[model samples]
Target: MKSKDNFEAVLFDCDGVLVDSEPLTLGTLRDMLAEHGWSMPLAECTRLFLGRMVRSQSALIEAHTGQPLTDAWMHAFYARRDAALHAHLQAMPGALAAVQAAHAATSGRIACASGADRGKVELQLHKVSLMPWFEGRIFSGHELPASKPAPDVYLAAAAHLQRAPERCLVIEDTTVGVTAGKAAGATVWALCSQGDADAQHALRECGADAVFGSMLELPGLLTPPR
Candidate 1:
């Protein structure tokens, strides 16, 4: 594998990569579904929700249940989930250190690209004290025409950073995110924070350049020359 030499910026995906909020989000969704007489297994919930935005996830649920997920349902779900997230979210292991190291190494060129809305991303980052590392550097799929599995979000993040697509590196934890990054012409490093072996293998098959179990291993991949 050839080492990357000209990567001037690092882009991150928020939910699984920066904060370990997937479990909370998935649990909240399951609980909400249960209120409507729908019960989803934890594994199935995780598979369905991983890397997908709330609106899209709701659409999927609508398709499955033959019931329209109305705006009221979405609003209520987000209100409850946001509160839970505020109370429980935490930075993923080594995530803060990795962001800091990357920022220091690149002179403040690290950015986050998330499937979450801007407010939710900001709130979680602030709660975990990781907001400062991303000052003025967060982009959301809400601002794009499409979310993960499409190149819009990553492409927007690259454009916001004023870096060429090939000059950026994307850190992602889902197959959809990896595909998006590659589609945007960025190299991807997949983190196995949410899924199992099969999922990790699928991410690589989709387009990840490498995969790691934790962000602690990222520094070596970005180690600067002496």
Candidate 2:
């Protein structure tokens, strides 16, 4: 396992880590999928799409809906998802405090590396008033050649911060994201904010260097930037 001390930067996953927007996004997706004749519970929808890019599931979506996952359909999903987020998205409890702590400990060397589209990530951050902390430091996997589970996004964020991936601390909320951070050679901490014991076990099994149950616990876990 990688040591957590003397990290040069903190790289955060945007969805479940910073913003409490997963349910809103997944609810919209579940509704839209139902409209397309592929009805499923939000839990199932989340199980299928959380921590991964939506479009990457095109094959399964197409097979279930008996329709092509076209660009227009994606745009429609984006529109609906954004509206729902704008209306109800909130920052995860204690996220602001954690971000402030990260900023101070890392000396402002922090970035939001997200698996979602740039537009969607930006919109959610803005809606929840987190845009100021992330702004130009946000790296969207959708803008890269690959997204989560591929390590491209975290690698890009670490590169932009001029830090070695191994010297960065990655905070993620899902196994797919933890996999990506580990693949990028970073020390990853999984946020198990919902107190899900199974999720904590899964995250540890997926190679998270540590697991935390709240953003409130983050500051204590970090050391001064290298």
Candidate 3:
């Protein structure tokens, strides 16, 4: 994971890394919680849950509400989420170009490791026409023993791609994911275009190897710094 090393693979965190769907999800969650008389600012919502799994979010909410959410409630929430995602989803700016460049640079060893469920991951990638790039290489945090901030999923991705963890490169947009990538010994870069200073600092503290504000900067980062 050294800056001078040539990476064998590039692993992406799907939600914020590939698609600009975090805001849509944040808005949807905010509205859903408002119905239950829970008020939270959008910033706090993103800070708490952007790169987390549904199961974790459910547990947190249940802990706060002092009650467990039923399957029916989760089902309904996801149904609404699907609609919102379908309506607002778009690829991250320059994302396709960045992915293509990274794939070519790594000789086609790119995979998506996301905190989202496989279904949602596939749907969002397909909606943005990014499915072809990741076809059989999609991985979900839901399948891991523990989610982001844990290295299991990223490590799994490196193993499946037949690459050593230290030779893998990871692109993430959250401190949670950066922590996981660092844990797995992959070099990580945090994309913080949508975030403020605190977000940048968090990514650094979590072990991001570099930080940039845009996807447009990715191709440059993928290459060894001269």
lDDT of each: 0.86, 0.91, 0.86
By TM-score, the better pick of 1 and 2 is 2
Candidate 1 C-alpha lDDT tens digits along 81-123: 8999989898899998889878876778899998888988999
lDDT of 2 by residue, 74-135 (tens): 99999888888888889998899889888987899999999998898888888878889988
How much is 34 displaced in model 1, in angstroms?
1.7
Per-candidate clashes, comma-separated: 0, 0, 0
List TM-scores for all candidates, in order. 0.94, 0.95, 0.94
The candidate maximizing TM-score is: 2
* Winner on lDDT (2 vs 3): 2
Q: Write the per-residue lDDT of candidate 3 for residues 28-107, one digit (tens) a residue.
A: 88777767656799988877777876567776887666667788877877888889999889999989998998898899
Give the top-scoring candidate (lDDT).
Answer: 2
Q: Residue 59 deviation, candidate 3, in Å?
A: 4.4
Candidate 1 positional error at 10, Å = 0.2
Error of 2 at 55 (Å): 0.8
Count of clashes in candidate 3 = 0
TM-score for candidate 1, please give it: 0.94
